[model samples]
Target: MSLAFLADYANSDDDSSEHKDIIGGNNISRSEDSNGGQGYCSDKEDVGHGKGWWRGLVCLVIGQNSQLQELASACMDRLCTGTGGAQAAVKPRYVRVLGDLHISLTRPFYLQRHQLSEFARELESSVGGMGPIAVGFGGLSTYTNEQQTRGFVAVDVDHGKESIRRVLDRVNLVVKKFGKRRFYRSPRFHASLLAVKLAGDREMSEIWGSGLANEQERIAQLVAVRIDTVECMLGASKYSVALDRTD
Candidate 1:
């Protein structure tokens, strides 16, 4: 229950102008303002189709400004190199570990960003038992017409593939109870920093228009992250949970 998803957000590029350089354009800088954690999401841009409950997980950053730097470093370390986007768009929340991951008991009447603080508290009180932590991630190449979201996060990990497998197995238990109508799709773990509505009944469209599904699949395969702490959000404020005491 202490699970929270980590968002890799806009690579080194926050502007998002150059499509070709989209690989790692997010700019996350790190500093003394540091904290770390483990966190969720399914494939098909894990954030897909969960707007009613999706409160988004926070990013694990060392510093608010330096958050982008950490992301860049992580990408470069694992990916070798990447990206291009508007430099200014990157912010402490957008470029770093901004919010927590917890489902909202209340749903917004209209399309709007749901607050995360209260839900985070709920997670701490409820699911704080699961631990050791595992995290997985991948970026979007494109989002299909039906996909409601793009992006992935996996957390509360330590063991490796086995650790991830264990969590997924448990998550599947919760997922099985819910019908597709609530999800209207498979359960995917994801984070949303910026969501845009489709203009004038046109329908929402992904900026990349790329293969987000495939991208998420690839990241999950490649990563099985380890974690120590996590954040939860609900009612707009943020909350934290420690993994050390995880059962």
Candidate 2:
């Protein structure tokens, strides 16, 4: 599936120093609060609870350097703006459109510290010799969740499909020990580009059916992405494990 439960990352001024500003040109204000008292917590507190954390494996696509990533982000802006309708006109909560536009490789799952460490070790051994994954943009599609409709720009990974399969196999082996389910049977690989709360669904539907449908092909072919490392998100932190560059 596509991603983004942590999109509005780094909301407070103190935490602002920990994050950088990128596409969409704004720092995501903390949806919670600085102290995290009844609000938000510092990074230390976020992970201290142990149970509140989960891990997600993903390949990075958008960041500070890519020209195409910049373009894709602009497209997101349009999709968000175009979704406004007769509803109360709430402002769209645009994700911080910078830093690693990614596609989830593993469903975010819970794991104890030792379990996560063992998984990391296994992952490192599995692909240390493999090179970068070649991927191409493949148009866009819409997905509906209980509260929102999200727009995903499909990604066509050259040799990475098989890698995704292999990785999932290993991941499922460990995750099952925790009684957690695995990845979607046939996960559509894509980068989540935009999200609109359900209130805007009617409007998003119209835009998707007409104006957007015609543009998918052109937009998808706009660029290619090469991913060289798999990143993991646990709690509020992110860490990377490199993939060897054989190509």
Candidate 3:
């Protein structure tokens, strides 16, 4: 029915640089767990403003700790408002917005801007020789689209998933360009906070399995993302591949 425009620019914000608010906005401070409440919001980097030239290679989901990012951004803003507002053709799709969460780890497809500074200096020397990388977020998953249903939160590359498939095979061998694709032979890493379009197709999966079953059981206890640096959105503006932690 509606895949929300195949992902409405896949979390547009012009590639967000950090406009704040991804959970708790800024006055973040909540305590009291044991399922009582509080477990989300851990933001500090968000930027957006779309322009066009879509690019990819993501990795931003650091240490959730704002009551599970304010209960996964309020359960993806109540499943993007259950799409009852009726899908518009070019706008009014605001179920909620703020940083738009992420954790792609490569799969975006598109490059140009003069080949993006030698593919961002060979992807920052191949992620600084592959160092710091310990992602995890176990639980919750979905990817349907007969009408829409893109909820995500399952990324636990325990053994570092072959070091992120060798940094997505060296970013498809230094981004040759021309709509690249290679990156998902079996890669299932995710972090997308939410997305809904179905109104009858199981009504947003029964409202995300009973309204996010107790915040997905306290977020399936397993949150930890630390991969140094590698943002790159390109087009709306945003590129990074920093790596020098050495710790």
| C-alpha TM-score for every candidate | 0.35, 0.62, 0.29
In model 1, where is the ten-residue run with the lowest total lDDT? 10-19
Model 2 C-alpha lDDT versus the unseen true structure: 0.44
CA lDDT, candidate 2, residue 42: 19
Writing each residue's lDDT as its tens digit, candidate 3 over 1-247 gives 1002122112322122343221221111111222111011111121111443334444443423464457555555555554422122212253333233545555454555576455555555555445556665656554443225432322233446666666666665655443465544565655544444344344434544544344545666645656655555443434445443443
Better of 1 and 3 by lDDT: 3
Off by over 4 Å in 1: 1-122, 138-185, 204-207, 211-224
User: Across residues 1-247, which tens digit of lDDT does each residue of candidate 1 receive?
Assistant: 0111112231110111111211111211111111111123322233323555432433232112233224333422222111222111112232223233322111111112433333334334433445655544454221122332322222222234354344444333333332211222222333232222223333222222222232343344444445544432222223444444532
- Model 3 C-alpha RMSD vs. true structure (Å) is 17.7
True-vs-predicted CA distance for residue 4, candidate 1, Å: 17
Clashes of each: 63, 4, 24
lDDT of 1 at 46: 31
RMSD (Å) per prediction: 13.7, 8.8, 17.7
